[model samples]
Target: MTIAEHRTDTTHPLDPMTTAEVDAVREVLTRDGLLGEHVRFAYLGLREPGKRAVETFTGRADLDRRFLAILLDLGTGASRSVIVSTTRNTIDSTVDIDPATEGQPPIIDTEFELIEDILNADERWTAALAKRGLDPATVRAVPLSAGHYDEPGESGKRIVRSLGFQQFHEKDLPWAHPVDGLVAYVDLTGRRVTRIIDHHEYPVPQEQGNFDDPAFTGPARTTLKPIEISQPEGPSFTVEGSVVRWENWRLRLGFNEREGLTLHQLSFHDRPLLYRASIAEMVVPYADPSPVRFWQNYFDCGEYMFARYANSLELGCDCLGEIHYLDATVADDLGQPRTIRNAICMHEEDYGVLWKHTDLFSGTRETRRQRRLVISFFTTIGNYDYGFYWYLYLDGTIQLETKATGVTFTSAYPGADGAGFDYATEVAPGLGAPLHQHLFCARLDMTVDGDRNAVDEVEPERVPVGPGNPHGNAFRSRRIRLTSESVAGRLADNRAGRTWHILNPDKHNRFGQPVSYVLSPEGQPPLLADESSSIHARATFATKHLWVTRYAEEERYPAGDLVNQNPGGAGLPAWIAADRDIDGEDIVLWHSFGLTHVPRPEDWPVMPVDRAGFTLRPFGFFDRNPTLDVPSGGNGGHCAD
Candidate 1:
């Protein structure tokens, strides 16, 4: 079956599995005796389930159509992975792991099922709150304020999930840290309360404050009359099922519960460009040195599966222009098909100008207006909202961007000595939001014309005055083709004017230059975390600005698939250990892009959505300016006159 097939809404192949598919898989597992009698079938969901361990696109028949189901075996207190081949109605495989965490705690705040239980039930969580000298009424808001599951500490011999509580006084503003120093540890494996650590015993601060206070909020915000943007002649882009057809470009937009959005079978000008392109993983490692903050780091894409938290976007607030929204399906915590509506927004936006020239040489000038089609998805993880954008340009350029906004992850302050910590500002009366890092990884499967590709490193240089007494004004262009997988990966060096290109040796433009696209870094990469840090070790793909490894679908996540509690093992670094052949072979390039967040006062209530990302522009793929014929004047403004 195709990626779009099996989904209830056959309109898009990448659509989430239908409830019928979930039920069918359950039937298969039962018929084959995969779900044991004592072992409770707690969750059964779509896994995307598997692509080849390598480039299986070369052989489509090898694709496996299986139901990826997970279970909680209460009999053995373990989590199991079950694969049922829908094609044969047989249990293909079964593996059990997470025995230690079987009876461990559930992430309380964000765990919707648990949260609803606490919010509605009169007795489920009342005692736990009472033990901490808290009145249920005093709690204005309570969310899953949690961190990584560490083996040591209070968990002891039991597998547990710990959560620190951040309470707000106002009924609506849960993030306005009015109350501090409260924590809850639960044993979900056994579904029992472990303890509630409330060291700073005091009344829940009841100053009644709204951090998103409207009185003096951001220079008297003004709402202009609604301005409508329209494409009177219809969009330049068209969606035929999952496939998108635009100017000189064609590709299928696919989504999985694991990876949020993917551009598959991408091509420009009817020329094969990429077989796959998506964010393999994203690491948001906080820099607070505290015990809680130290291990509090996270692989956002892996641990949390950012794709699952995709927001149901609003029209004007999210995007402008003729926007086409896409939906995503995933099994809920209970393994039931759930649809995330409006998960992706596809539209076109005017980008200042493609190219323009006002010449003094001849009283003649030319201008090229520009517009870009954006495939975007936004997700709110805890208090932060991250927007992922893939821009399709008229000049054969593709840009991937990320915008981070939403409230900061604030921490209640220590009693004293707030000297060297990330203590940014008193967002609330007694709370401080620590500065942190948000590191993102984008995996580009550059199938330039075909899968066999090479990475060509190019650096700007100054030529020495020698050949026939050449003038010193001459510059040199140095190029190198990586021969092995080990050496193919590299870091970005702006000082050297370095830019790397994914080259197709077999294809060339009329100018005889290799048809390729260069990865251009937007800014200097972040480096506070190093190899010594376990977080970075797992995310070895972030070691360099770019990594070239032979195509292997299993290595999709540079930081490994199970990054939650996993420390520095089984990812890109481990794959590179094989030192596989890379030259003239199907290659996957992992590009790391990030920005260090040192939040300020203005970033308190909610950080303004600031954007930063990289772009892949056509290098020698085109002989001349592609937008040279773009119209110069349209006289476009707020609204049609």
Candidate 2:
């Protein structure tokens, strides 16, 4: 019967066995040993289940009268076996005939019935497999490997041949030695080479100086080695014939006498002249020599200035109470028949103070009034030189921002770990902390020109001004609150000691006025005796006067806290404080200026050439000393371990 018909016939139920049934199976299978041979049964229906049954029986089967005829297949011995099926029925059988003498006979009715009975016990079969530590569902079929055949039609023949012989064809061998001296072997399936074995005797090339064997004993050509230069230890040039030329361009007096005329190499300290002039012209309607006052007044003040002179040899102005100007003069010195075609202006309040009278020709009301000054100077002693200075004066105290362009040092903020820890928690428990110290420090030297007889030690005090005051009811005055202890004291006490002089403005120049003062010889003192107070409070004070407490917390006209509550407003402009959100993720601290106090002549072509810069610093405004232990890059080895 065909495999399909056999599967159908074997599925039928059979009657209980009788003596005749047993004898009929015995007579057909006892006479000839049908067991002890590896056999396969193919099914047309339920192929997988049938195959599983065949695998479990380990024998061949065929359909019989009312049951399946099965052969006992131990291959090597005459043995008894059982078959079970999915229905929990079991069939047991024994082949009594000897295969040594009589050839194997066809399976009989009795054997078929017995096999069918066993296979019907599906549960028993499952239990038997489970007992034997096998999971029927998880069982996999392992394919047998046969040698390759030259023709597709010869595959069966090749398998037959491969089964009879122990060795295979060279191409079908499953293992090979590569022509490139590598050994390759196929897996058991004989499909492809699974692995390659390398047996070369020499080692592969490797990068030199791996981590395990780090050696720095080469010629040192790859690294940069410092070069030492020792010039004859003496003055390089004699000062002979060196006429001190006051270079007007660079606001400095150069010693070189190359050009007969004295030249001033204008440095940052000299920039105030330009800044003041520009600001003045910007404020006063008749301030500029050009007859554009009526036109300028129509447009936004700063825009008008920029449109008129941003690029031209004129001055530009801003809203800040300051002035800036540019002038080209044939006259040699500052005070001469100079065509000082410059501009001047001021903020409304400052303008009122400088020019109180309504009359245009009236001289300034107060010559000694505080003024915000910005200056730029350019000169050429030998090469191009420029300088600029920004001055803010209030209540007889002045703070100068000086910059010497081109002659400045560049620096970077310290890495994360250097700044000190946040102390906000220590102070206010939950509120944020103030920065322990400033990330940058600048040094400046200034010369003041005022009433030589004016008392330098005026002991400035907070005075009131308003409607009832003598100055008229335009502005109100508030008491100035200068903290008894300043950042100067704290910096002096820090380990950096005298080197921290940059933060102590008092040590650099006394209140923007020429005075004798130095950093306290002793180190800084403790900022606060008690840590419970707000660290911010300990660092910054609320004030009104520009010289004392000009910083505000909010944009509310007169009285408010400082923006971000940062000490010293963290150098941010009061107007910027109004905006809650800015595009950049971090707050930036910017400071720029010119350096040197000298002015020269070469800077005249573009007189008052100045350098201006800004810095973007991390504003962990609420963080502790951000640069506490940061080592200064060069010459800072003194603190290194």
TM-score, every prediction: 0.84, 0.16
Give the per-residue lDDT of model 1 (tens digit) for 36-146.
Answer: 654444444344432233234334354444566656554344566787765455677887655333222122122433432433243535655676666666554333323
- lDDT string for model 2 (521-608, tens) is 2221222212332222212211100111112222111111111111222222333444432111111111111122222322211224
Model 2 / residue 36 / CA error / Å: 99
List the candidate 2 regions with Cα displacement exceeding 4 Å: 1-313, 317-340, 343-385, 404-641
Clashes of each: 9, 104
User: How displaced is residue 495 in candidate 1, in Å?
Assistant: 2.3
Please tell me which predicted candidate would have the highest lDDT against the true structure. Answer: 1
lDDT of each: 0.66, 0.21
Cα error, residue 379 of model 1, in Å, equals 1.2
